[model samples]
Target: MVNNKTCPGCGVMLPNKNLEFSDQYNASGECIQLYHELSANFIMSPDVTFRTQHAVDAYGAQHSGNRVKNIRTAFSLIGLYLAVEREYTGRQVQHAHMELAKRNIKWSSFILPIRPYALSVADVLNIVEVKRNEMLMEWSKNVWDTWENYHEWTRNICKSYLKHF
Candidate 1:
């Protein structure tokens, strides 16, 4: 029950699959580790969330890159979220002004810089938030103006088809 928490819908190990049916064991342990961290702490715990080299070797080399990419995506999102908090919340979350030094960006370390940037994480966060808000607003407006009037579109399509017929 503690270590082997399988999906409610399936009876396989949480991280292992019963390959006869793909959906039979879909809730992965690695996935749940990240999910619980985000749900409980609202922050990414990079150390705890990914597969080891042994696990990757045991599973398949083909999936190794995907596992690392997923871990990196979590880290990037946390960085972006911290930047957003710095933009709007200001000292509310720890590491608000923090950013990766140019050399350290390639290493993906969480170390505070020896000489931090004047440009600041908050500026990056604010830009990200603004861009995200702009895209979301545009998408919502497009959906409202286009897809929400699906009945009218269908009617027009039918009318145009009848005219051709």
Candidate 2:
């Protein structure tokens, strides 16, 4: 008594009567569950920017003001450091920068990506801080001796960067 139906989990056509006995019949599968949740939330969200016409007409809003100034400054500094570091290490920094620019990722989207590189510098800093804190906490037990050595290596890398700067 198998009825034709769709296996919502993997989007495969199956028997409707077998769906109850199948282990992969979920409509909201794990593959797209998170994306669906995010899309739904975004659809119901309101636009609150003061610069928008709706906000201005409703509440006489003022300028929204610049938000990414500090972040931009930090990114510039980081980019300069990276450039200097690459030159000091005999790497083709200009070529890399040009390639990135060719991909339409200049100063604007260089620090951002669609997925993997989308993380901000602040996020990297937070991760570094967490590792440092963990190392410090375990220093008394000598558990982070190797970690401390790794920090020294990173410091040397930065020193080489500063040399070219």
Candidate 3:
């Protein structure tokens, strides 16, 4: 039922059936318009909601510093996913720990410059991508080497560890 028109928000092709014209002046053109408005308001507002405040407060209680807490939260979420879905254990855990250690170093280097401001999720992702690129460039200096070795080694370690479990 899709027509040739593209969505004004995301710029992808829009379905013809879902596109409706209303006589009312104030009616949003589509669900995408409502979503865009909500997202814009969320970004424009400086004040955190009560729920976010409570969550931040609870998170702060366990962690001594803001950066450390945020990084720890990120790691905890990653670990949960790996453990629950990936079923990583033993040497897999060790491998993950090593990777996380390197990532922490990279994150620390990136965070020191931006520590003064309260960062949004997008800000953190941007910083991470920047640091990751920097790390990759540094790694690529050895022209004879390939990226597969690191991954293969980690996989071997994981396979070995999985044998015992």
**What tens digits encode model 1's per-residue C-alpha lDDT throughout 142-163?**
2222222233432343243323
TM-score per candidate: 0.18, 0.17, 0.23
What would the TM-score be for candidate 1 when compared with the true structure? 0.18
The reply for model 3, stretches above 4 Å from the true place, is 1-68, 104-165
Clashing pairs in 2: 3-16
Tens-digit lDDT string for candidate 3 (1-165): 445544331223334446553222112145234333434543454533211222121122112132244444333333323333354442354455456655323222112121221221222223453363233222222110222223343345445434442
- Looking at candidate 1, what is the lDDT of residue 164? 28
Model 2: per-residue Cα lDDT over 109-151, one tens digit each: 2121112112111121234533532321222112112223233
Give, for candidate 3, the lowest lDDT window spanning 10 residues. 108-117
| Candidate models: Cα lDDT each | 0.27, 0.27, 0.31
Model 1 regions more than 4 Å off: 1-12, 15-34, 41-67, 70-97, 101-104, 108-165
